[model samples]
Target chain A: MSSEVAVSKTGTRLRSPRHMLADSATLGPFLTLLVLFVLFSLFIPKFLSWRSVSGIVNAATPIGIVTIGVTLLMICGEFDLSVGSLVALGGYVFAMLLLAGAPPALAALLAVALPALFGLLNGLLLVWTGIPSFIVTLGTRSIYRGIVWLFSGGTLIQMLERPAVLALFNGRLDVLNELLPKGANFRTSLIWFLLAVLVFQYLLTRTTFGNHIFAAGGNAQAAAAQGVNVSRVKVISFAFSGALAGLTGILLFSQFRTVRVTTGAGMELSAIAAAVVGGTALNGGVGSIWGALIGVLLISMLRTGVILMDIPFIPADNFEAVVGATIVGAAVLNTWLGQGRAKR
Target chain B: MGRTQDHSEPLVRMEAIVKRFGTITALDGVDFEVEYQQVHALLGDNGAGKSTLIKILTGVYPPTEGRIYFEGRHVRFSSPRDARALGIETVYQDLALVDTMSITRNFFLGREIVRRLGPIPWLDMRAMNERTRSALRDIGIEIRAPHEKVGSLSGGERQSIAIGRAVHFGAKLLILDEPTSALSVAETRKVLSYIENAKARGLSVIFITHNVRHVHMVADAYTILRHGRKVGTYYRGELSERDIADLITGERER
Candidate 1:
């Protein structure tokens, strides 16, 4: 009799509207993406074409990859503004190493490791000096970009010789492209992006380290009192952010076959905007990696839709105004949804 | 209760603990002890060094001059983690729980159960959820589900979860800092029962509070501190409620 009562009570709670809303934190962004997709398809001719869809996906790849790290760092209650510069730094390091006759694999490893090291340095400075991460990364962003400028001598480093390994990162997906309609353009970079999303989402949801990340961000003092190494978690998170940014640089170079000092300038704001639109909390400890991916796709779709619409007053070069409005609107909607869930 | 066979040595003993923060002495030559299966109440007014003494015991700070013995062996802690490794758990006044997280997640915050998928470790959420529910139920706290956010629970329920987590994690010494101060009368009664339940399970608890009535209700032995000095340590019935109050306020002679 007692067990029956317990079961029924749990059943009621599981079916509660508040519980349903809490479980659907990512649902709002996903629905918005669908609605926008349908509206764009209805109004704009050729907007639903495979060519156009793949273009949006392809253009979102680099920033999509960067947002993965940015979201993780933000969830841990820290920020890495240096990632934009780190992206260029990564491209320079990879391009220089390859130009010097180094092995492609070795160059790639160092490309990722160097940025990760700088990220670790950022974490060390933040922890040791007790400075806010925003200030620390803000300072490092200039220093890293300066390094990129010095390395490239403020010129573009273009590779005339394309290595076979470059194809592994951003090569055209010939088989999928052949299977799709004419003008379809897909790349291996999208696969890598999706794989990263899966692996990181798994890490954030299914690992002890992931639990520590949430706890450290949610309540640092409480987590420390419970024997969690909050500083180590934060430092490691910073390293991950750097590594991912470096990976983004590799992807960018693979596609363009060139590295410049201004390769990823202003990308930091875009990645942060994507993370916030994906329902990640600015204060930390509440987010989903899947939501981040959706956010990237949503923003890219918006960009494509606005260009297709070609509104009289809004030029293609000024599409950022629309994207900015979407970021704020999505954030406001997420907050309202969160409050509704909490109130219930 | 039968685990109290070894009465010759106390579970924990702090001798001549003098903690000085620059020029201010937070704890001066304070001696305290807790026996097996006993609830020892450490009582004091504001700035009476109760927090300092607890901090030293839990390895948050190193005493300027003192020695601590646990289970008849000398012990020194550089951090709270070291103390926890020795089966010492402290539920702070804030409870050290992440309100945004689920009850099961908060219950297994630091020590999580994981299954290795090759080189990767995956949290065994099903097993953890089951264990969390059973553990809370064992401590007489039945809930709707383990996945409910801890923020939704009442103050009393939250305290129960914290205490239940400590007990489930194999803590030999549980230090609760003002566990009932923020709770209502009914919640206080529930927490007091939880303390009794912990004592019944053979764990030595250090109940730190300012409530003399609460100390009178559950503490097997009580220690009072006034101005960073130990007034006395007395077993139950040795001091009445009025006497404990007077001693706490420095109104009675030691």
Candidate 2:
């Protein structure tokens, strides 16, 4: 036997180009985000102000919170298309409860819990019928959307004008204003989003359930043979997706002070796009919570930049085309990196 | 269901096991047994109920009609989890491993060791890493790192990891399904040594393979099944190479 094939003493293989490419797939979005930030600062007047920066953070939080669950579900090899509907439903329920004299805390709890039931249903149908989650969630998207219409009678619910709810979710961190005056005013939702990111990051990396999610998503039959309850993992992940969507809805409702019937329309796709662009595979078993967060920031930054820029050819509504293109481009790059990984 | 310290009884015994899949009978009246600390090779041609028998024994699927006795106790397993809880582990042909997961994570996939600190039981990564290192070393294979992804390992190394994990978890009976079917010559030799090492450590092994040559070296006893019926059981030296080959091909009847 050749001595070269023996194990290295340090127990770490030298990083090859393939490893570098894989790392690039994860880190590439950060560079894009930075470049967009720089380009917007250079071209757009008032684009470098704290108001603009905080605007981006505030806009990113709702979608960012929802993406955490979407990312975890994707990692566990599932999807929830009903997240947008859940956001609308959550806000509707919260607003309705507040109007009916319910406490803010109780209203918020029911809002999050109600949408989570839909997620549970998505998971249950997938497990019981052995259907693909894509199809299952597609069915659920309309069901939840119908519920949103039925709840609001196809009109925006604006009756609840509670200052306490707004102060809790949409308030700025005024304590920091003493430091820099303008720069220190940060949205409270950013704090919620960051906290969600940290908690989920810990859940995904530091615990046994997180490991099981990867294994269950990666190779379910293998995981089953080893005694992992693959069905339970998928179920819990879907619930997380729904609950986060509810939270995002509550945050958006607080920001706008009204629950629109079309509150979370198409945000589900945006979350998926952000997660994929951040390096999550649609097939599952390969993603990180941190990567998905970067993706959310990148997409938010792109949209913010595109809306602020004075380009005549590209309309504001056509910003979705950029997101679409980013998804295709990232998938291609991921496939390239995947080929390199297989070679090694 | 009595605990008898009878040395003469087999560790696991199956009698008249029958398994039917809709209209087709996969296994019809097959009897199999394995002794304690002995390597028993289950050999048969394709569609000869070799896999069906193993699945029934390991609690993957219940037999349509049969009884299984484990350690002198009549047992019926509802699922593979139940079988594992009883210290019976099966290393499938694919090794049942998540490739993208780290070796330590894969090593303790279902049964994770956690540190109970306040309320949440966090993964004891340091202990898992140390255990994975020593377990692989015990099987004569030194990995680059315990945290290295299992996908980077070669075919034989993956098999070793699965076997080592099963042994470490105190599997009384390790059922290996074609461990050497997809290996190179050198890799096959390495897997054979793993089987031998497993046996030396007082673990009863049910080595299943269609290939007779791979199991003959380390197998102490051989059970040949043809068309869902056992032809006979023989000691290691009782049957010659040609005789075993003929039995596998069902030429003994002619």
Candidate 3:
């Protein structure tokens, strides 16, 4: 509607304090991770040890992987509570396939594919039924966990004697071996986790699909008007969440050589916590993979710190208190960073 | 009306369109047409089947008993994507933009320029940014950076960007659904002028609004609907703003 109305003469657009704060919102998570790392190292000398650092990275791998998908789905304004259940389901699938004489790689692929399929179903149900994703995924969560229990017969699936299958994921990196007298036990899962992060980060920031995701999540009606298949975008996001959970399950299985019925029982909450701590808005359309990476690292470090400190009040088994506290704290900080002065 | 353009074929024509949701009829029978290179206004009150008519034309829904012709060819669009593929773009009042996204991304939301590197198409970020800057500038919307988020922009600025995007993408029929209902007088004028600019560029516009005054300034023809039926189609010079308003509000007996 161009008439005699001139271009906005609002002067040169200066970066306002509001814009700066919004930018800092993303950086907030990374900064918190850095601050926590420094504080931990200062107070707990063990945190500075190469062993502790490696252990933190190793433990962070599966959680980081799960966080990647959860963060992506969250950015698209959907939640997948079933990821924890999917992880357990995947472990059972892998274990069952391996026992059935299937090659480890094939078992692993099927394991990943199963959860991806479930994710697709979750997304389709959400889109087609016009139900809130939280409700749909919440229903699927228990259903998937039940399926896993049925298959496993409520018994632990254990393969304690490590085969080449387990070795592929839990193998140590030779490069870091010379740095530590005990030999660097850097788990291959960490490499896989970081690789997933880099790939997803590229997808979210440097691709057209990534742009569509933000659009769909930010405003579905707007996205639909632009001819972006919002339903497809959401479905794909759910699949990513489910598939990553499966991969994390595989990693967990490889690391411990055991899959309990409750292997990933409360992991969905922890994964969400990690993403929230990394500055991912639960409301959606504003987040980063790098932030989630930092978040998972922070979560792992906190868990490890509590265990190392041996604080009588906060037992190692009760690390969830720290996680719950961090989630609340991070959520508050994120809101503060995003809260700009109201527009006049 | 206004300047005559040789009475060529209309760009879009919907004949006796009737839509029903269950037993309730939204549109009984309505005929609407928009000539090429003219701003056609659709005026109606609430529940006057204006939304139903627009939805049918835009492929959001198919009429229960009606046929739509685009460029004199009968067509049935199952979804909005199909309609968009045929060069029909609708800019809703909300502007259909993701505020959190960069202006460049919003400009090329579904139609992104990608470098065909391997199987995965990587976004041509630099090219897209440059194009968005020039595109918005052509429409008299100047932002400091194309990479700036759309949320930071004012309401009118966002509408301009949406209009610019539709124009750049070669839309044959640009539909504006109450584009000025939420804008200030200045912003409304700016948007109205852009509609005029679009008409000059040979794009047919379906300007849907209850405000007859704004439409009077730009629309070459007016189609007024009342009680899910068309009252009449009047040319610009044939009716005053008051007459059109009465027609929309059903104040004047048929």
Off by over 4 Å in 3: A1-14, A21-25, A96-101, A180-185, A306-313, A336-344, B1-7, B18-25, B64-67, B237-239, B250-254
Q: Which ten residues in a row are the worst by lDDT in model 1 chain A?
A: A1-10
Give the alpha-carbon lDDT of every model.
Answer: 0.88, 0.85, 0.85
Task: Let me know the DockQ for model 1.
Answer: 0.59
lDDT of 2 by residue, A1-344 (tens): 22223445665655755565564446666666788789889988878888778777777889998999999999999988989999999999888888888888999999999999888889999999999999999989998999899868998878545577777787776755455546656778888899999989889888989998999888898888888899999998999899999998889888787888888999889999989988888888888888888898888877777788856876888887888888999888877776655555
In candidate 3, what are the lDDT values of residues A26-79, reduced to their tens digit?
677776778888898999867787788888898888888989999999999989
lDDT of 1 by residue, A29-81 (tens): 78888998999999998899999999999988889989999999888889889
Record all residue pairs in model 3 with backbone atoms less than 3 Å apart, i.e. clashing.
Answer: A1-B190, A1-B191, A1-B193, A1-B194, A1-B195, A2-B193, A2-B194
Judge candidate 1 at residue A254 and give its lDDT: 92
Docking class of 3: medium
Candidate 1 local lDDT, B74-157, one digit each (tens) = 999998889999999998867478876889999999889999889878999999999999998887878677988776577778
| lDDT measured at residue B244 in model 1 versus the true structure, 0 to 100 | 92
Better of 1 and 3 by DockQ: 1
Q: How would the candidate models be sorted by DockQ, starting from the highest?
A: 2, 1, 3
Question: Model 3 chain A, poorest ten-residue lDDT window?
Answer: A1-10
lDDT of 2 by residue, B73-103 (tens): 9999998888888889999867479987889
What DockQ results do all the predictions give, each relative to the true complex?
0.59, 0.65, 0.54
- Give the per-residue lDDT digits (tens) of candidate 3, residues B94-204: 747887788999999888998978887789999999999887677566767787677766778788889989988888889999998888899889888888877777789
Candidate 2 stretches with Cα past 4 Å from truth are: A1-9, A20-25, A31-49, A159-162, A181-185, B1-5, B21-23, B252-254
- Chain B only, TM-score of each candidate: 0.95, 0.93, 0.93
